[model samples]
Target chain A: MVTNEQRLACAYLLKVGEPPAPALRSFVSEHGVVAAAEAVRSGEVPDSVATETSARRHIDTAAEDLAAAKSVGARLVTPEDEDWPAWPLLPLTNAAARGLKWASPPLGLWVRGSASLEESLQRAVSVVGARAATSYGEHVAAEMGYGLASRGMTVVSGAAYGIDGAAHKGALNANGRTAAVLACGIDRAYPAGHSTLIDRIAAQGLVLTEYPPGTPPARHRFLVRNRIIAALGAGTVVVEAGQRSGARNTAASAAALGRVLMVVPGPVTSAMSMGCHDLLREGLATSVSSVAEIIESVGLFGEDLVTKPDSAARPTDGLDSEALRVHEALEPRVAHAAERIAEASGVPLSRVRALLPALELTGLAERCESGWRRAKEPV
Target chain B: MVTNEQRLACAYLLKVGEPPAPALRSFVSEHGVVAAAEAVRSGEVPDSVATETSARRHIDTAAEDLAAAKSVGARLVTPEDEDWPAWPLLPLTNAAARGLKWASPPLGLWVRGSASLEESLQRAVSVVGARAATSYGEHVAAEMGYGLASRGMTVVSGAAYGIDGAAHKGALNANGRTAAVLACGIDRAYPAGHSTLIDRIAAQGLVLTEYPPGTPPARHRFLVRNRIIAALGAGTVVVEAGQRSGARNTAASAAALGRVLMVVPGPVTSAMSMGCHDLLREGLATSVSSVAEIIESVGLFGEDLVTKPDSAARPTDGLDSEALRVHEALEPRVAHAAERIAEASGVPLSRVRALLPALELTGLAERCESGWRRAKEPV
Candidate 1:
C-alpha cells in the first residue's frame, strides 16, 4: 500500500520531475517517500538532487492531481503494483543491446480503460510501420493485425495514421483486445483527428503512457514511447517501414531485448517496404506473411506450423562424379548403347552400364530400344 | 581439316544420334567420325550400339543437311572446336554441386549469328523468368536486362515470351549484345510470334542452340535448353517465377553449376513472384534490384564495393553495462547532475562522472547546463 507520504512524493515527482533520473529514483527508493519529501522541504537533500521551486510549489497540487486521476477512472501503476509488466527487466537485455542509452522501461504507467495492462500485455504482438504507408502495406498490416487479434493476442501500436491506424482498426474490427501506447498523456490524443478512435480504444481496450496527465507529445517522447510498445509485446512485427522510419527503432529495441522480430514482405518497388526488404536481406528479421506464421515464430516451441516446401526436387544433385560424367556423356534426345556411352565418356563399359540404371532411376537417363538417352534434364 | 569422310560421318551422327552419349562419342573420339560411321555401316559396332535401317536410309541426307547449313551461313561448333564455352568445365563445378546426373556439357552448337560464342559469354548475365509474367515482373526484367547490357555485360536468356522476350527487347533497346539459347533449330522460331524478335537477336546479337538445325521445339527441349542458359552466363537472375515455374529449374541448374544465383524481388501479393520470394527466403538466391547491385554481387573482389551506411548510428552499441545504465538513467529531454544520475542508477558519483564523458563521446549521452541528457540518436 502506498502511504500518504509515498503518494504525495510520487505525485510531486510525477508533476515536476524529469524521469529516468538516477538521483531522484535512488533517493525515493532508499528513503521512504515521506522522508524524501521532508528532505526536499527542509532543503537538506543530497547536492545531486534538484528540488526546483515549481516542484516545491506543486507539492500541494500533487494531492489534487491524484484525486483527478481517480475521478477520471484511471489507475497509476507503479513498480510495486502487482499489475506492473515485466519490462523493467530490460536493463539486463539492453546492456547487451546497447539500446539502454535511449530505451528504458517506464518508471510507472498511467493506464485507462477496463482491460488490465497485465492481461493485455501477457500475449501481445506489436504491428508498426510508416505513417505514410502504401495501400499494399496497409492492407498487409491490417490483415496481420486482424489475424493476430483474432487468434487471441492483444495488438499493440502507437496509433498514428497509415499502418498504425490501419492496424488498430483491423484489431478493433475483429473485436479483439488492443493497446495504444502513447507518447503524450493518456488523457489526451496527440493526433487530434484520432480523438474518437482513441476514445473507442480506451472504451474497449486500453490507453497507456508514462507521461503524466497534460503532457504534450514531443519528438523525443515518441522515440522514448516506442520502446514501451516494443517491450510490452511478446514480439514486434514491422509491416512496412520506409528507409528512415521511427518503427525501425522499435525493431532494434525488440531485437536487443531478444524479442522475436518478424517482418512482412512487400513489393520491393514500394519505398514504404524498403526497410522491410532490407531487414530481411540483412538477416535481421524473419519473414512472415500471415497471422499463423507470426504466431509460429513467437509461439513457444511452435512446431504446428509447416514450412514452405523447397521448389528444388532435382535428384541430379545426388549423382556421383563418375555417374554424372556418364550421364552427361549420353546425348539429349539421342539414345546411346553402353559401349558408345563408355567410349564417349571415357568410362569403362562395365562402369557405364553400372551408372546408367542408377542415373535412370534419378530421372537423368531414359532407356529406349536403341540404348539409353539422357533425360531432358538431370535429376 | 575438312575430311569428306569425317564431314559425312559427323552429319550422319548429328542427324540420328542422341547427345551426351559415351559409346557413340567414344567411337567418334577414338577413331574419328569416319570410323564410327564405317563401323555402323559394317555392323562392327559395339553390341550395345544400334545399327538401325532408318538412320542408314537417312545417310544420303546427312551430307545434304551439312551442305545446307553452310549454304545458310552458319557454323556447327563441335567439342573439338577451340571456341567451346568454358561450360565444358561445368563438370568440375558440378562435381561440387552434385549436378552430374541431369546436367551435361553440350556436344555441339549450331550458331546462326556472327557473334563469337566464346567471347559473347565471357561476361554475361542471364535474366529469365515465367512465360506468363505480370507487367511488374516484365518491367523489372526489362530494366535489369537493359541496365546489364548498358554496362557492357551481355544478357543471355531463353527466347520465350514475357520475361525472356522483355529481357531480349531490353537489351536490344539499349543496342547491347544479347544471346538467345533456343530449344529448337536456330533456323526455326518456336513461339512463331517471336520470329521477328528472334531475327533481331540473331541480327544484333547471337542465336545459338545445341539442337541440330531443322529440329523443332519440344516440351523437353525447352527443359534441356534451360541448362544452356544457366551455363552460358556468369550468373542467372530470376525476375519472376510462379511456384512451379521452369525458371526454378534454371535456378537450380545455376546453383548446381555454381553460377551466382540472384532474384529480383516483387510484391509478395503477386503469385508470379512467389518462386523468387521463396528462393530468397530459403536463402537460395541473393536479391538485386538494379544493374549496379547485380554487378556488385558478381564482381571480382566485390567486397571492395562500399557497404550501405547503417541507419542506426547510435554508438550505444559500444557502451559497457555501467555506462549503459548511466546513459539509460539520464532522462530524455531533461538533464541531471552527475551525482543525481549516480544515485538513481546505483553507480558511485565518481564512476557516474567517469562514464558520462565516455558515453558523451560515443554520442549516447551529452553534457548540458543541467548536467547530462541522452544525445538524439547518434550519427
Candidate 2:
C-alpha cells in the first residue's frame, strides 16, 4: 500500500539535523516531498543551506526510521491529507509560520484519536497556565473546561500539571472530550507524573505529537509545542500566569495568529496573575471570568450550543421555583444569606437546605464560606 | 476696593444656582463688570430674567451671602482674570463643566501664599487616595510629593487624611510649594486632625476652595471637589484605593478630562490596590512606581526645574573619582554590596563608605536595603 517515492521522501527529510525538519516542511508544503527529493537528488537545492546539512543526510536515515514508524503502527500525515487541520483558513495563521525554522514540518502530525483532526480543530479551546497553579486557578480552569466542553467544544492543552491537568480532568469528569498535545512522541509522556492523564486523554479524546514515536521531549520542543496548542484552538484562555510566564509566550503566539485571546483576572497582588494583568493592560486580550464570556468571544454559542437535548443538564436551567423565589427576594445591590433567602421565600429551614442545592445547580445563586449570595458571573 | 457690579454678578449667579457658568464667563471676559451689569439690568441676559417668585427670593438671599463673603475676605476669581488657572486648555476641561453647578465661580481667587495661582497651576500634580490609606500608601504618596515638589512642581490634593496629609507634609519638609484644595471654606480645615498640615500648606503654598469662606464641608461638596483637583493639574496620580474609593472617582475625572491618569501598583493581593489594578487593566491609566516616572509622564524634569543657584546645593554632581570608581566596579544586573563595591574598586573600606554618599548624591547608583543597583536613570 506504500508508495516508494513517498517513503523515500519522508525518510530523507526526517534524517536532517535540528532545523532540517522545518525547512523540509516548507519545501514539502510548497513542493511535494517527491519534488523536494528530486531537488535534493539533482543537487538543485542548496546543500550548504543554513542548518540543512543534517536534513540532507536524514533522507537515507528516514528510510530506516520510516520502517520503524510502520512497525509501531504510526502513520505520517501530510498537508494534502483529508485529516489536516484547516487553521490556515484563519487570517492570522501566517503568524505561526515562525515555528517552521526550528523542527521538521512535523513530518505531518502523528495523531491517535477517533475524532477527525478537522472536527477537533473546529471545536477546540485551549485552556493553559502555570504547572504550579493555585487552588483558585485550578477551580476556575476546571469550571471553564467543564462549561466549554459541555457546550460541545473539545478542550485542548499540553498534557502538563496544574491548570492543564485540571482542565483535562474537568472535561473528563463532565464526560466531555479533551485532547492532550504533547511535546514528545505519542508514546512518551514527559514529567512521568502525568502518565495517567495522558492515557485518559488518549482513551477519551486524542494524544497527538509531531515527534517520532519514541522521541523524548526537549527544552526547545516545549516552546515549539505551545504553537501547536495555540493553533489547534479557535481561542486561548490563560487562567493564571506570572510576569515572565510561558503562558505569555503562548498568548503572544495566539495574538500574532489573531486568535481570540482571553484571560481570567486574579487578585492583583498575586505574582502568579501579573501576566494576565499585563496582557489585559496591553489590550492584547480581553478579561473573562465565565464560560459564557469565552463562548461569546469566539462567537461559538447560540441556539445550536445552548438548545440541544442536553440543555436540561445545563447549570443555568436547573433552578427550582423556590430558589427562583429566594433570588427574587434579594435586591440587586444587596447580598443575602441562606437564612434570609429562606425567610424571604417563606420556606422552612429544612426545605431551604434542599432548595439551596437547586439554586447553585441552576447558577441562580452561589454559596461562599460566609453565606449564600446571588450568583454573579465569574470574576 | 470691591466693586458693586462684581458683587452683584456673584450674588445673582450664586442665587440662581450657578447654571453652567461658561456663557456668563464669556460675557464677563468680553465686557468689564459695569458692562455686564448694564446687560443684566437691561434684561438682555436670559439668566437675569428672574420672573418667578422663588427666583426673585433666591436672588435676594444670595445678595446677603455676597455681602457676607466680602466681610470674610472671600474674593471670586472671574474666568477673565490673568491669575485664573489655565485648566481649560486641557483636553478634558469640558468634561468638568458639570461641576460648575455646585459652586459660584470666584470673581478672583483669594490668596495668602507667595506662589502665584497661575504658576501653581502650570506645575500642579494631584496626589489623592483613601482616607484610611495603609502605611505603604502614605509612604509612596509622601515620596511622590517630596520628589515632585523638590523638582519645583506644586503638589495638589484634597486636605484630608492618610495619604493627603503625608503628601502635603512631604512637600513642606522639602521646603517646596503645594496646594490643598478644600471642599469646605479655606478658613476651616476639615478632618480637624489635619489642621497642622493644612495650616502649613496654606502658609507655604495655598489653601484654596470654590466655597465661600465660612462654609463647612458637606458630603455632597466633597464629591464635587474632586473635579477641581483633577482640573487644576496636568495629571492626577492615585497612590492607593479600594474597590469603591473616592480616589477612583478623582482618577475617573482625570481620565474623562483627558489628563494623564497614573496609579501606583501595589501587591496584587491588597484589597486597597485593586482599584489601581482595575484602572490599569481597563486601559484607563498608566502604572507608575517612582517619582521619575511621574515626572516623565507630566513632561517635567529635575533639570528643567532646578535653578542654577539651587543646583549647586543639590546632592547630585558632587561625586568624587573614588565614588565613580566604586560605581563603575559594580556589574550590570548584579546586586553589589557597599563592601563588594569597595573590594572591586580596590579602595579602602573607609573611603568607599565616605564615597557612597557622593555616589548616591550624583544619582549614578541607588542603595537598597540589600545592596545597590545601577540607577536606570539619574535619580
Query: Chain B TM per candidate, please?
Result: 0.78, 0.67
Residue-level error in angstroms, candidate 2, position A84:
2.2
Each model's lDDT comes to 0.73, 0.66
For DockQ, the strongest prediction is 1
Query: Mind giving the per-residue lDDT tens digits that candidate 2 earns over A256-362?
Result: 66778987776544667767766775678876656766787777756333221221233333445444445554444566666665544434345567776666776
User: What is residue A176's positional error in candidate 1, in angstroms?
Assistant: 1.5
Quote the positional error of residue B184 for candidate 1 in Å. Answer: 2.4
Report model 2's TM-score to 2 decimal places.
0.61
Candidate 2 chain A: 10-residue stretch with minimal lDDT: A303-312
> Which has the greatest TM-score?
1
